[model samples]
Target chain A: MKTRVIVTLKSGVLDPQGKAVHHALTGLGFDGVNDVRIGKIVELDLADGTSEAQIDEMCRKLLANTVIENYRIEQA
Target chain B: MKSAVIVFPGSNCDRDLAVAFRDVTGKDAAMVWHGESTLPDGIDVIGIPGGFSYGDYLRSGAMAARSPVMRAVAEAAARGVAVIGVCNGFQVLTEAGMLPGALMRNATLNFVCRDVDLTVANSQTMFTSQYADGQSIRIPVAHHDGNFSADEATLDRLEGEGRVAFRYAGNVNGAARNIAGIVNDAGNVLGLMPHPERMTSDAHGGTDGRRIFEGLFSALA
Candidate 1:
């Protein structure tokens, strides 16, 4: 089985890199961009019988820092 | 005081921290590898120095927080051992849940490396006892991810309890409330982005950082 985890900064948190990219876009003459927030996607290849609870544990333990970020896990 | 400095794979400031510990405590600080499952017996202080641990992979100090030695550090902290996490060490403490808040990229999107003025917020803790309350001092900080953030309620609690140990005199890294360093509720653990070890001697252009080590040694003694 394979799992994908999307980690994103929580709302109200500052994303400096995302802001920098947004600025560059504006400088390049792009318009109508309200905001931008950057995040990361982590793909994991797990063995059979991996439980959702285990994946959630992984997210809580290492994949995401609950203090400033949130993570979603998807299995396929 | 018996002290130990945790050395991760990419830790470059472990020696500097050890020297600071030795100079203040008059004892040879042990160098414990991150792979160790346990620290040396009867340690009074544990120093987590600055460096690009694990090359800051995944996240700054994220991988190191999960290393074998951090488990031991957490246990020691629970036993009332003094733990000081500086720079990357601060990131590890937050990641290990030993401290609250997360350090994000600087708002300037640039790596900041210079001496900055800091005010001693609370001098009652074991870590800041050497400095007078509201005293201004200069410390050097070198990091790209030193911006500290925490929820409003948590920040309020930290402030209410006087857990904030140091606050920047000027906004250096966009940290919330200008927090330069903080202590845990138990007052045994401290996490800060500035490198006190680098400022330990006058030869380094300042000796303001030496007070922290001196304070810890006297408290532990």
Candidate 2:
């Protein structure tokens, strides 16, 4: 089984890299952009029947820092 | 004082930290590898130095935080032994959940490297006893993610309880309230982004960082 994890900075957290990209977009004449936030996607190839609780534990323990980011696990 | 410096694969400042420890305690600091599950006997202080540990992969200090040696460090800290984490070490401690807040990337998105002024927010900590309260000292900070931030409640509690050890004199990073260094609730663990070890020797320019180690040694003595 394969799992996909998407990690994103929590709301109200400053995203400087995202902000710089937003600026570049504005400089290129792009408009109507309210905000931009950057995140990462981690794909894991796990053994079949990996329990949901175990995956959640992996996210909490290492995949995402709950202090600054949130993570979503997707099964594929 | 019997000191030990933890060394990860990419830790460049481990030797510098060891030298600082030797300078203050007049004894060589044991360089404990990250893979080691146990530390040397009778360690009075532990130093976690700066560098791109685990190549700063996944996230800053993320990979190194879960290493074997950190478990021993945590146990020693629980025993009231002094633990100091500097630069990348600070990030590791926070990632390991030993520190209160998280260090984010600099607001400017640049690697900040320079000698900046740090005001001693609380001089009563085991790490800052040699400095006077509110005294401003110059030290070098070289890191990309040194912006320290925590929730409002945690920040208030830290300030109220006097756990904040150092604060930037100006807006060096986009740190919340200019917080530069902090200690755990027990005041036995300290995590700071600045390189106090780098500033300890006179040949490096100023000896402002020496007082931290000196204070720790004297306090332990």
Candidate 3:
């Protein structure tokens, strides 16, 4: 089984890199862009019988900084 | 006071921090490797020096924060041991959840490296008691990710509790409310981007940073 963890900065937290990327996009003449926020994606390959709770625990422990970021787990 | 300086693989300021600790505490500071799971017994102060720890990979200080040594540092911090994190150390602290706020890239998207003016925001902290309130001093900061940000309510509460220990006299980084340094809720942990250790001696161009360690000892006494 493979799992993907998507980590993103929580709303209202300042995202300077995201802002920089947004500025770059605007400079490139991309329109209809409302806002841009940067986040991380971690893909994991787990053995059979890996529980969702275990994946959530991993995300909670290290994949996401709970103080400033949130994480969601997807299995495929 | 006995001290220890955590040395990550890429830590460049570990020796400088150890020298500062020794000069102020009158005892040699142990250089503890980041791979170590336990620190030497009865350490009083722990210095997490600045550097491109883990090569600034996966986010600055992110990988280092999850290292084995940080666990010991966090436990020591909880036990009332004084912990000071500088530059990359500050990033590690925030990543480790030992301090509030995140250090983002500089708002100007530049790596700032110079002696900048700072105002003593709260002299009550063990880290700042040596300086008088509102006094100005200069310290060198070299970092790309030093911009500090927190939510409004947390910022308000930090201000309300007098935990905002230092503020930039000028806009060196785009830190909220000009915050340069802050203390943890228990007041035992401090994380700041400026290199106070580098400015601790007059021979180093200024002794303004000496008082911080002096204040720490005095507060402990």
Q: What share of the true interface contacts does each candidate keep?
A: 0.94, 0.78, 0.39
Q: Give the native contact fraction of candidate 1.
A: 0.94
Which model scores highest in DockQ?
1
Task: Give the lDDT of residue B130 in candidate 3.
Answer: 82
TM-score of decoy 3? 0.94
Reference-based lDDT, residue B141, model 1: 94
Backbone clashes, candidate 3: 0
Over the stretch B112-145, how does candidate 3's per-residue lDDT look in tens digits? 9999999999998999988999999999999999
Which CAPRI quality tier does the interface of model 3 achieve? medium
Worst 10 residues of 1 chain B by lDDT: B197-206
Candidate 1 — which pairs collide? none
What TM-score does chain B get in every candidate?
0.99, 0.99, 0.98
Error in Å for residue B72 of model 1: 0.7
Report lDDT (Cα) of residue B7, candidate 1. Answer: 97
TM-score, one value per model:
0.98, 0.99, 0.94
Question: Where does model 2 exceed 4 Å of error?
Answer: none
Can you write out model 3's per-residue Cα lDDT over A11-51, one digit (the tens) per residue? 97777788899989999999878999999999999999999
Worst lDDT 10-window in candidate 2 chain B? B193-202
Interface RMSD, all models, one decimal each? 0.6, 0.6, 1.8
